[model samples]
Target: MRLRPPTNMVDPRAKRYWMAGEAISNGVVTLVLGLLAFLIEPARPWLLLALGVALLIGIPYMIIMPIWRFRVHRWEITEDAVYTRSGWLWQEWRIAPMSRIQTVDTKRGPLEQAYRLSRVTVTTASAAGPLTIKGLDHEVAADLAEKLTEVTQANRGDAT
Candidate 1:
């Protein structure tokens, strides 16, 4: 299936941030491996060289795969429900009917703050069951949370 973001929702910086984060994380791993190789003498040179090459190859792989996979992430909003599709290993899709939504929360962390992004979490009646959608513009996240809350409340005739 060719999954795509909603036409009305656009996150132009998602891929850039995703790739940058992967690069930073991979750099850290490479640094740790380099240090370990330096401390161990027996295979030090070979290990260091191998790790250097691996880091070079892995960096592109890490950045490209996630961004490509995320390009396939999609969500659709209908009159009474929202549908989401995501996953690299075990692809799956979920539909959350407005009537079944108990609450919606918008969250942002330090990194997300730097990126000006936020995550929206939707809670349902199932115990401890919540769906989290991330990498959204902060304002859009808040608006989505508000819209979800309004829809849920309208369906139930009660505010949560």
Candidate 2:
């Protein structure tokens, strides 16, 4: 079936959240490489080279990925289904019909909580797995979960 972009974009603060998340992960890798470079004197040159290469890669990734993701990520919920588009390079689109949805849940990791953001998960019987709408405001995610739950329950079907 043909699909177009969803109607809503995720919260704008998600950009900062994504950057911070990538920064933390990249920071850890840099720290490890730096420590190894200092401690292993014989391999210092190679380690430094590795660190430089990592920075070259990580710096651009830290800058670009979040912006690209922000541009790509979108979600929309209607009376009949929930639609989402996500990912940066490897993009995905999903639609969960109310009749097929088995569960609706919201998730907030420590970082997401710090950013006051949440992810909404809609599980269906499809083998492809649950559909997620990430980077939503916490309150909005909760309301969306509730709305989806209500709609799915009202749909008269086995949710198969």
Candidate 3:
């Protein structure tokens, strides 16, 4: 099915957090690889050069890719369910039917708090079936959690 945009689509502040984290992670990987190369094969300068090149290439990709992906990402809440589609290369689409949701949780970490963003995790009875929606505004994430809880409770009432 064609993806639908989120009703409350706003510019996610979490992009900066993600980019910063990505850069740090890539930098660490580059450092470790450089160290390993130096210790194991000090003669091979090419390995260190390759790692440097990867770091240089990766930083820009980390910055730009998220913006592009976020532009393409969509979330839709229909009468019966909520659907989310995201990612560039390995696109993923997830559907959380109201009936299947057992609980909805909202969380924010130090980075997320600094960026004023949060993540919403929806849990189901089925093992390995929970879904998380990340990079949402803190307030929006809380609201989504409340709505999901309400929907799930209402569905349970109907079933009984």
lDDT of each: 0.73, 0.92, 0.75
Model 1: residue 45 alpha-carbon error in angstroms: 3.6
Best by TM-score: 2
Total residue pair clashes for candidate 3: 0
Q: Report the C-alpha lDDT of model 3 over 52-146, residue by residue, as the tens digit.
A: 78888888889887787767566667778878766766788788777777778999888778888888887777675667777888788888888
Q: Which runs in model 3 stand beyond 4 Å of their true positions?
A: 33-44, 157-160
Rank the models by lDDT, top first. 2, 3, 1
lDDT of 2 by residue, 1-160 (tens): 7788999999999999999998997899899999999899999999999999998999899999999999999999887888899999999998877789998889999999999999998899878889998899999999999988888878876788
Please give the distance, in angstroms, between residue 82's alpha carbon in candidate 3 and its true position after superposition: 1.3
TM-score of each model, paired residue for residue: 0.79, 0.96, 0.78
lDDT of 1 at 14: 58
Per-residue accuracy of model 1 over 20-74 as CA lDDT, tens digit each: 6777777887888888897888989887888888888888777676677576555
RMSD of each: 3.4, 1.3, 3.1
Give the least accurate 10-residue stretch of model 1, judged by summed lDDT: 3-12
Q: List the residue pairs that clash in candidate 3.
A: none
- Looking at model 2, the pairs that clash are none
> Which consecutive 10 residues in model 2 have the weakest lDDT in total?
149-158
